[model samples]
Target: MNIGVIGYSGDKNLEPVKSLKNICFEIGKLIAENGDTLLTGGRDGIMDFVCESAYKNNANVVGILPWDEEGNKYLNTTIKTGLDFSMRSFVLLKSVDIVISVGGQVGTALEILGAYAYKKPIILMRGTGGWTDTVTKTLIEDKYLDNRKMVELYQAYNIEELSQHINNLRGDVNL
Candidate 1:
């Protein structure tokens, strides 16, 4: 299955929150070990960190780029949407079976909303800060978003829990 990771691309320095970056790395490693493909925005922050770990672990990495720009050396496959950020985000969310949100800003929130609109399952890594934390606290109630029974929002406090949740979703107990 392809899992899309959406989060902060960081500032001009391209520096991600240290602790959140570590969590994203572990999540990527787990995804690879479980024989899953990794998808991302193909920029910096959580996207770069997770893609790097997934690549090292020999997972297929697909980057949904907003433009035809180069410099995404980590991605095994690149899909240049040739669209603006918002439209590109829709493609990213639509291409994946599941979506995972790390710490992020407006972009991440848009991705999450896109996932919901697509009716794709989403797992929010709590305590990672940014909009992810806010979503965990506000937007969802009783694990459902906006009383939308068709889509359920899941929260994982750590990598282990996140792994278990993914495994459960796949009906694999061995992971």
Candidate 2:
């Protein structure tokens, strides 16, 4: 499966950087260990952090870049769309089977909406700050993003929960 992880791609000196890094790292490692392909916006912040972790753990890391600029070195494959940020986001989400949102601002929110519009399952990691922490509040019944019910949004407070969600989505039912 191809899993896309999106979040902040700005200043890395924020107060939550350390915690976010740890969370992103675990997410990356989990994706690698599960032998799933890892996809991202292919910029900095959450994207770079998670890609690096997954790369080191032997996962197939792909970065969907907005333009001709190079992606993080950790990416094994890079797709340059030559499109602007917003346009590139849709391309990225459209290629993924599922998406995981960490903490992010407008860009992350846009990606989340794109995933929803594509009807791809989204796993928002809570407490990582930014949209990951606030998007749920805006959801209808904390599940559906809106009246469309395009897709049901799922939340993961920790790595374990994230793993479970991925497993469930893959239909790896233990029962």
Query: How displaced is residue 152 in candidate 1, in Å?
Result: 1.0
Question: Who wins the lDDT comparison?
Answer: 2
In model 2, the runs with Cα more than 4 Å from the true position are 172-175
Model 1 residue 72 lDDT? 54
lDDT of 2 by residue, 1-175 (tens): 9999999886456655555888889999999999999999888888988998999999999999997979889999999999988899999888888899998889989988889988989999998999888888899988888898888889999999999999888763111
Query: Best-fitting candidate, measured by TM-score?
Result: 2
Scored by Cα lDDT, where does model 2 land? 0.88
Give per-residue CA lDDT, model 1, range 1-175, as digits (tens): 8888988886424545655667877988998998999999887777888998999999999999887755256799988888888889999887888888987889888888889888888898888888888886666564766766567778899888898778777752122
How well does candidate 1 score on lDDT at residue 38? 91
All models, RMSD in angstroms: 2.9, 2.7
